[model samples]
Structures are given as structure tokens and as C-alpha cells.
Target: MQRDKLITAEVADLLRPWFSDVTVGAQPVIGDAPAVLEQPDHAVTLTWRVGSDDPHDIVIMGPRTQARYHLERPGRDCLQLRFRPGRAADFLGRPLRDLADRAVDAADLGSKSLTAVVQTIADGGALAASQSHAARLRSLAEAIPVAPPTHTDRAALHRRIVAEATALLSIGDGPTHEPVHRVARRLSVSERHLRTVFADRVGLTPSRFVRIDRVRAVLARIQQKLPEVSSRAGYYDQSHMTAEFRNVMGTTPDAFARRRWPTIEACTAGNG
Candidate 1:
């Protein structure tokens, strides 16, 4: 697969202060590759990948639960906008699961007009501008109509959930140390409630999120040339790491360290 590049827009600079070092650009995704799921630290993303041969590539919203499939061609590019959990939920107006596992065509998803959304948000007129990209997204959102439950007060709920999740992520190896209960306590909610919220907004539970986070953290450490990647990532031992690797990634850590490491590493290094 070709390395993905960030498609920078004029308005991207506005997001810079928040994302700081993260890269919020676009890259092309080619043919289908293996499925790799990720649990991101900050935002959920709206993603589009176009291939050279096929005009109708996939367009997806990569919530926490969804596995982002790898691209076969290096030339395939993607456009990604990362958002905080609450903002993401508000923007999408629905639980992430509603969009999962379904193959959506680029045309149906309005691929040609995406730049308008970028332009709108960049101009600081996301909610105000009638002709702006943000407005266009709202319009599209209206047409698609995937907004979250009306009674849930999605924005407030998302804020609370994200805060708790972030706090849990701050503690290294959260998943390994009774992750489910720890996260539930941090949120001042029961484990069942936490799972429900996460599933509703992110399409996954807290436990699964922790598992994915752990795998990504270990892989990141290894890429940085850190010694004992497993230990540093809070794995009790190599065996423990291997078990996690199998559970989350469906592969051995060594295989990931050798083959698929760069894609995620690049994503981590470049995510804005």
C-alpha cells in the first residue's frame, strides 16, 4: 500500500492549536488490505479513500469500534477530520454504530462536495455560514439523518464520556489494570452505563476501547525503538502482550511490529 498523505486545506490551520502536533491531512487509500481496528485518543474521524482505478471507493466514519481497513495502493488518498467525542457525536448527530459495516459509495456519501465542508469549518463559520462547508455537512447530515437519540442530550453525554475516557487513557496500561471498572469509576458511572454510552457514541464499549488502546500503545513504543515494548505498554510479560495482540489485532505482535507497524505509526505521528 502507498503511504497516505494529508490533504491540507486552507482552514486546517484553525484546528492546529487543538491538535497541535497531530496531522489532520488527507491520504489516498487504494485496494483493500487487512482490517485493522483502532481506538483513537482524541477524536472520531470522517474518512474517505479513493483509488486510481475505481472511482467508487469507500467512504466511512471511523468511530472507535469500527476497524479501519488497510489500503492496497499507495496512491490512494484519504481525508480525515478528527473530533473530540462530544463534538464528533454532535457533528454526526447519531451513534457511530448506525454507519458501521455498511459499504457506502462515495457518490452516495457526497464525495465530490466534501471540500465545501472543509472550507466551511475553516472559515470559522461552521454553524453560521449558509454556503460554508459546515453548513453543507449539516445539509448532508439532514438528508442522511443519522442524528443520535433526541432524549439523550448527546452533547452533554459525549462530554462526560470523553472526559472519563481521557482520564482513563492517561493512566498507562489502563486495560491491563482492571480497565473496565477503573474507567467506570472515573466516570462516576456504573460499568454498564459506561459501556452503553461508549457503544452508543463510539460503537464500542470501554473494555474494547482499552484493549485497542493497549495494542496501539505497545506498537507505538516499538516503533519509537523503545526497549521492551510490551513492558512499557504495561504488559505483564511477552506472553501477556501476545495474548492482547491476538485478541485485538488478530496477529502476533512480532508480525505487526514488522509489517503493519508503519501505517499506524504514520497515522499516530500525523494525526491532527
Candidate 2:
């Protein structure tokens, strides 16, 4: 079947220093077949979409693994934003570990500030709920809540560390197996500090995040039919890749390799 692309706008330039991308647009989706909910593999996402029951606004999707779940409503438009790893700290105003694998109702990220706007939509005021989804999100960016510099040296250091760590982990297209010690040494911080910042900021132990990234990376390569997916993508070998893949993805690499993912492919940008 031919692939369909959801419209994606790079609103990253608009929300700097906190959000990496804001994806606003809807795509045509056919009804979906039941499928395993792929583990939490994408970047931290803020999503608003039309649903079977009603509209879902201010849903915060964190990072972690899970079992079966359904996709978003078919034949409906979805709006979403993805935060750069470790960058969600200020906007979310909390540790990410608390929300992993859950799409909990969001209160932060300037959601409270948009209450009047959303309430108006709910009450059939200025805009319908459908129009409100994207507009409210854009309002979120325009709000651009900047905190007064009340943080101590320690807080600023932590942000810098997490930001650098996020960049380090993101290098080379996928996750790295480089020793945490080496990474810490390169970043000029101790391993203990590195792990703490990762947990507090990006919401995973450094090792666990790396493993998830490796598995997700290899799967992306497999999906694209890229060569040497295992080795080139940083797994020690095929066995290593398969074990990690099955652990996070709940399916074997070969199973994913041979299968077509029309539903998964339909809306791509928000996955980060």
C-alpha cells in the first residue's frame, strides 16, 4: 500500500530552550487493525487528539515500556509536540520517571495558563473543540513561560549536565554502549552525578536509556531496510539485538522485519 504522510510543522524554532519540536497537523487514517502497543520508544511528547470518547487535550506521554494498547482514533486529526531529552525538565517542572509509559493528564507545560482558552472551546465559545487543539498548542508556545533566574549554581549545573548528557547520548544517530565512566569522564562529571541527572532530567538510568535507544534505533533501521542493522546500529551482534528487541518491543526482530506497519507508518513526526 502507498504510504500517507501527516502534515508536520517544525515549530521548534518557536519554542526554544525547552521544546525541540511542535508537530501540528492532521492526517487521514483508515480504521486500524488491533496491534501490540509498541513500547515507549519515542521522545517525550505532549499530545492532543480527537478520540472515540471525546477530545484529549494536554496528554503527557513519557518514556518507558508497556504491553497492549490501542492507537489514536482513526480518521481523525492529531496534534502533538515532542521535547528534547532532558529538556522537558523546566516545562514539565518535575522528574519524568514519575510518568513513564503513561499518558496522564497534564497540568504543567503551561496547560493551566491555557485553561480559559480551553474552557471557552468546551463551552462552545470562540472555537469548536476541534479547532482549539492546535490553536491552544500554538498558544502554549506563544506563552513561552520563562522562569526568573531563581536557581542556584547547583540547579544551573544540573541543567547543563543533563543537556550535555542528552547531546552525548544523541550522538552518532542512535544510542551508544560507550562506558558510562567514559561518558562521565568526557563530560567531566562523576558517574554517580551522571546517573542522578539522567534519572532526574531524562527519567531513566543512563544504562537503561541507552538500551532502549539501541533497540529503538535498530528497529528503525530494520523498518527502513538499512544494511547491517545490528552491528551498524550498535548492538554487539544479532543475538544481542534480538534479545533487546524482544525485551522492549515484545516481538522478535525477524517478526518486525517481515511485517508491514501501515498503522505505525501513518503518522510519523510525533514519534521523534
Candidate 3:
């Protein structure tokens, strides 16, 4: 199917920085390919196939620490909502640590807002395709709550630390990125304290977050050569980049660059 890339101004204003992308009509393209080894994602995702045939297919996927191997069936029209790093806690209204590397039924999260949005999709069914992409996104945007709940002093402190830490970790000087201890020091908190808060909010440790962020950076620039991509992505060398890719992506950089992965058009400017 031909894809449309457009974001209505109203939806864009509402979902910025918190929700990063809304992928409509996404289906994997696999031909004699082994199980796709997906890298760790910092954003928690809500995914459900379109149409009433699978109304109950809604899933809430938490941030992953390790790589996962899964065979995605072709020809399934999937819609996904990807929340920015550490921002899903506000919308989902729960700690993410328990959800690390897990995929659960949307009902399990007890998020009324997400459930309502899913209902809208279910009601729209195949007719949703006839509407403009911007119109559909506006509908979903309207159903979602923009404001986060109130937090106590300590909870607020943790949220602040996690937010700053995620931004710093997402952009670092080397392969190790910002050391956990150093980041803690900058935030005026103990290393252990930062780790605990980060895990609670992001569902992954600071180091793991850095690793995944680096891989994601590399993934975004698959058109470049290994040497250039490695250096730009803060890897020690091409070999180091390949090894890290193997560990987190379950495939070498060269091989992955050649594969026919699904197209993901970002709907917002926020990289988180």
C-alpha cells in the first residue's frame, strides 16, 4: 500500500515530545528472512492490528533491554503509538520497571485513555482507511489525555532526574556514553539512586539505555558505510560497532543494512 506522510497541526501540537511516532498501516516485508531480530527500544509502544477481525489484538509493549527474535506475519495492517523515552509513565500511569522486556495486554495496564483510543479504532474498522491520515490521527489525539497526574515531592524528584538523565544519555561522547556515576553526580544524586529511578521510569538501566540509543542512532543512518557510521555513532571502531550490533540487534551491521525493514515515518521532531 502507498503510504501517506502528513501530521495535522492539532495532533502535532498535542503529541509532541511525549509521543514520538504514530505508524499507520505498517506491515513487515519478509521474504526468506529469518526471524527479525529487533533491537532494544526505549519507547514503550501500543500496537494493534486494524479491523474488527482482531479487535482484541491490542498490546502494550514496554521498553526492551535485550534483543528479541520474532517472526512477523506479512499483510497485517498494524497501527502503533510510540511514546517518547520515560514519557510513557505519565500517560500509562504506572511504573515501567515491571514491564521491561515484556509485552502485555492493554487491559493489564489499566490505562483508560489508551483503552478509549483503541475503542475508537475498533469502531472505525476498515473505514478508518478511507479517512485522511491526519483526520484519523486527530481522532486518536483527541481521546488521549495530555496532562500527567500530580506527583509527590520524591516522585517528582525522580521524574526530573530520569528526564535529564535520558537526555544526557541519549547524547554522549563515547561508546560508554555518560558514565552512570558521572550522570548521578551531575544530577546531584547517588549512582544507585539514579539507577533506581531510571529503571522505574524507563524500564532499563542507564547503561542499557545508552546502548540502545547508540544502536538506534546507527539504525537511522543505515545508508552510511560502517567506518563512518561507527565513528559518528560513538563506537571505538567498525569491529566494535559490529560486536555491539550483534549483542543488541542479533545481527551484524552489514547484514541488517541490506534487509527490507518496515518503513517508520516519524510524526514528531522529538527524538525521545
Best by TM-score: 3
RMSD of 1: 9.3
Error of 3 at 74 (Å): 3.8
Winning candidate number (lDDT): 3
lDDT of 2 by residue, 112-184 (tens): 4334334443544323446444445444545555431335787678877876776666425653556677889
Give one digit per residue, the lDDT tens place, for model 1 in 1-272. 11123323323343432222222233212123243334333245554332112223323444433234343334434444455444444444456555433434333444333334433333443334234343333333333223323445756766567556755654354334446777678667887877777767665566666666677676556454433777667667878888876665555667655555334322321111
Q: Where does candidate 2 clash, by residue pair?
A: none
Residue runs of model 1 more than 4 Å from their true location after superposition: 1-13, 16-43, 49-58, 64-71, 100-154, 170-178, 223-227, 260-272
Q: What do the candidate models score in CA lDDT, each in turn?
A: 0.47, 0.57, 0.69
TM-score attained by model 2: 0.72
- Cα displacement (angstroms), candidate 2, residue 18, comes to 2.2
Please state the error at residue 200 of candidate 2 in Å: 0.9
Deviation in angstroms for 174 in model 3?
9.7
lDDT of 3 at 248: 79
Residue 268 of model 2 has an lDDT of: 29
TM agreement with the true structure for every prediction: 0.58, 0.72, 0.79
